[model samples]
Target: MPIFEYQCRECKKTFETLVFGNQEVTCPMCKGKNVKKLMSAFSHSSDGKFTSSAGPGCGSCSATSCGPS
Candidate 1:
């Protein structure tokens, strides 16, 4: 099973859950079955340096720029 992030269409809340093969997802807050899978961001480290695939906003926010100048 893989963990996936989802946004509830009914409650407009976000949550993470482990999904099995073809398993239905539901929102934990509202118990809504109508949910949409979100695109998850990832990061990696090389030579003790951390990098994010999100490019900005630390991969968790919608900010246009949040990196060091």
Candidate 2:
């Protein structure tokens, strides 16, 4: 089972759930079933350290102008 993030439309609370099949998702705070799934950001690491070509801020710095000049 994969963990997925869901935002409740009624109470605007964010929660996570392990979905196995067509299960009805409800908010843990308000118990509202009307929820929307949000795309989660994830990173995998084996040696506890990971590096990428993208500097930071989710690759938003495409101009490469981040520095202390």
Tell me the lDDT of model 2 at 35.
99
Q: Write the per-residue lDDT of candidate 2 for residues 1-69, one digit (tens) a residue.
A: 587888999999987678888988989999889999988524432232323445653344555565334
Provide TM-scores for the models.
0.56, 0.57
The 10-residue segment of model 1 with minimum total lDDT is 41-50
Instruction: Compose the digit string of candidate 1's lDDT tens values, residues 1-69.
Output: 387778999989977678999989989998889999987522421332233555656555677687565
Every candidate's lDDT: 0.72, 0.71
> Which stretches in model 1 have alpha-carbon errors above 4 Å?
42-69
Report RMSD (Å) for each prediction in the order shown: 10.2, 10.9
What global local distance difference test value does model 2 have?
A: 0.71
